[model samples]
Target: MRHLAFPLLFLAGCTRTADEPIDYDSLRAEACTSACAVIDTCDPDRFAGMDPEDCFERCSTLLPRLQEENQCGSREIIHLECLGKLTCDEFEQNEIGSDLSEPSSLDFDAPCVTELHWAVECDHKEPFNLDEPAPTAP
Candidate 1:
């Protein structure tokens, strides 16, 4: 019985350590891909007449900045929020010179932006005291 108990405990300890370490580089690339997809879906008209290579180049330029600002290791929701804040002007300023002509319109009020703001402002509060029940409604 003692021998069996020791083996069982060792196996349990091994299982507890089985989760793989996060790969930040891969995560950053995935987040970048997701950000570009959101832009492509949400504002197709913006890229209508643009060259495919140019669009790819712009997105490539933005990916490193996004990775730097958002910390690719953070939760996916936070990454989405970072993406929501990204704008065409930001891309131009980072990639090209700030003196370039401005587009007539740029959308920064996507639904994800609102959700991100709400999460940051409201949902991220600390836990309640042990004696108090968490608020059921807000």
Candidate 2:
């Protein structure tokens, strides 16, 4: 019975046999939409070579959503992917190029973060606790 107990416990822990599902298509669409909106706010001729702020603003508006949705990785992907869509040489030459690192933590409150979170992953069926702060249990 003792031998069986450990094996059963182990099996119980391993019962689930799959990774989390990601609605990649929806996320991509959201990101592209937000990017288009931001781009619309700027002058294309003025924005093409000099302004990375316009691009960053769009990313900021989108990335947070992606993190909250558990698609934090998608934030990075969107930034890199936008290079192909928008030909802002400054962003490629200075902004993301200078850093290959990631943000230290996810901040869901920000619009870009929120957008990014949703753009990268789906808010799984699990409930979210927006009112409660993260617990720091010892």
Candidate 3:
């Protein structure tokens, strides 16, 4: 009985603790930061023409989807950025020597926004672990 009791106590102590509660507000802010960084890295021209704060506000709708899709990490951001840069480069190459003025800014519901999200989703190389807790800000 004593031996069994000791082993049970040891096993109880070794049991994993409950996971920390997710702070969605923080996650949203982090996602916004990551999204902005991707835009800045991939398409500086877009970043220059757009207001970051406005962009954040506009992107709020995407935050939930991004979090659900597990597309909110440094690595994921870098991947999306690279894909975006390539897409922009291709677009520029095709438009070479064309007399095109910069178009007026559009909101998150714009076609370009959908295209960017699609590009990231399609180009992601790794699968995120859904079982793991969402990332928290430092």
Candidate 4:
């Protein structure tokens, strides 16, 4: 009984606590991976000479900028969320990233993406918050 209690307590202690901040490193990595997977499948020819690796790396390198945009209350969270939910089917139906000839032109179009055409840049900023619910105390 004593040994059982010890293992159970150790496992519980290893779990995340409510006060901990969100790990943006892991969060961004996952988001980038997801978005890149969709692009690799649906828009393989998005660039003139780019492959899946190039696209994934490109998405990864934008993490810092994404974090900054989110911190600035650009609602980047929605963009990241939309990217994760992006499907090849949606890409085909909506003609997203469909234009392979114009590499320099903006062709990305998705319904889930919000404020993508905001004429103005994000100005006001707010405290960084990922908006996830706080974990309940054990």
TM-score, per-candidate, Cα-based: 0.34, 0.26, 0.32, 0.54
In order, the Cα lDDT scores of the candidates are 0.33, 0.34, 0.34, 0.41
lDDT of 1 by residue, 12-117 (tens): 2222222655444554454445555545544555556555533334554533332332322133323343443456554333222211133222122322332222
Top of the candidates by TM-score: 4
Q: Model 3: what TM-score?
A: 0.32
How far is each candidate from the true structure, as Cα RMSD in Å?
A: 18.3, 18.0, 19.3, 15.0
Is 1 or 4 the stronger prediction by TM-score?
Answer: 4
- TM-score-wise, the better of 2 and 4 is 4
Q: After superposition, how far is residue 130 of candidate 2 from its true place, in Å?
A: 15
Clashing pairs in 1: none
Ranking by lDDT: 4, 2, 3, 1
Model 2 agreement with the true structure over 1-138: per-residue lDDT tens digits: 000000000012322223645554544445445444434443344345543535444444444443444323343334333422443442223233222134344444322333233323433444332211222211
- TM for candidate 1 is 0.34
Better of 3 and 4 by lDDT: 4
Measure candidate 1: CA RMSD.
18.3
Residue 97 in model 4: lDDT: 39
Residue-by-residue lDDT tens digits, candidate 3, 39-127: 44544454344444344564554333444434333233332232233344543332232212322321223223323333234323444
In candidate 4 the C-alpha lDDT for residue 51 amounts to 46
Candidate 3 local Cα displacement, residue 110, angstroms? 23
